[model samples]
Target: MRVLVAEDEQDLADLVATGLRRHAMAVDVVYDGTAASERLAVHDYDVLVLDRDLPGVHGDQICQDLVGVGARTRILMLTAAASVPERVAGLGLGADDYLPKPFDYSELVARVQALGRRSQAPVPPTLRRHGIVMDTQRLQVTRDGRFLRLSLKEYAVLEVLMRADGAVVSAERLLESAWDEHTDPFTTVVRVIISRLRAKLGDPPCVHTVPGAGYVL
Candidate 1:
């Protein structure tokens, strides 16, 4: 899943972004509404964690604008206001979900994950292909019943390919879904990760490069 976190509180924003990344979600953070708008315009994010009182261009407007344009990005608005009316207002502005501040971290993660799922075509939590089995809920992967140890990035890339169900997936698509904005477009990061993944998945080499096209599993 790819996520954008728009929060004016630097510490809170960084914390949320880092935690989401640990869950194998590609995340980008902006400290203000203006920067958030800029990033939103450029990236096709699956979810947006927006603070309702964002500086520069209130989060309400951002949510409304995105909904107005029919963007598929799911919005989860956050605020310190715990009142019922406040949440109603946020949702009325087009937020898909709303969470009050001082919320439990686990709940926030669950909400984001749930929203991410809504943003994309439905897929089973457990993916099976080419003798490889991925239990997304447990963050576990096994090939022919042999459990595989993979880094977060490796797991994310593998998920994207497995979800493709034998269709070719380009390097650019992998980067977009598995990496944040900070990654260089020309970097060999995807290839390096793919190499590591192939080694871990072992023999029979199901992952294949299609030369000028992309990769397939």
Candidate 2:
């Protein structure tokens, strides 16, 4: 899943982004609403972790603008206000979900995961294909019941490929979904990761490279 975190609190924003990345989700962090708007306009994010009160553009207006444009990005409005009225107001402003401040890290991850699923076609928490099994909830992967140790990038790329269900996933798409905004578009890191992933999966390789296209499993 690709996520855009728009929080004015720099520390919190970085913390959340780091946590999400550890779970193999490509995440972009922005401290202001303007940056958030720019990222939203340019990327097809599956979820937006937006702080309700933001400077420069205001998160409420950002949500309104996204709704106006009919964007599919799922919004999880966040703030310190834990009142029922506040949550209802945030939802009324077009946020798909709401979470208050000082929340549990696990719950935050769960909420993001839930919103991500709602943003696209429903998919099981555990994805299985070929001889590979991915338990997303546990961040575990196995092939033929043999555990596979993979880095965050490798795991993210593998998850993207497996989610394709054998359909070829373009390199551009893979990069978009597996890496953050800091990644260089022309970098060969995707190829490098795929090569490593193929090796880790062992014999009877499941990841196949399409000469003129991309990769499939």
Name the top TM-score candidate. 1
TM-score of each: 0.98, 0.97
Evaluate all candidate structures by whole-model CA lDDT and list the values in order.
0.93, 0.92
* Candidate number with greatest lDDT: 1
| Residue 79, candidate 2: alpha-carbon lDDT | 89
Off by over 4 Å in 1: none
C-alpha RMSD values across all candidates: 0.9, 1.0
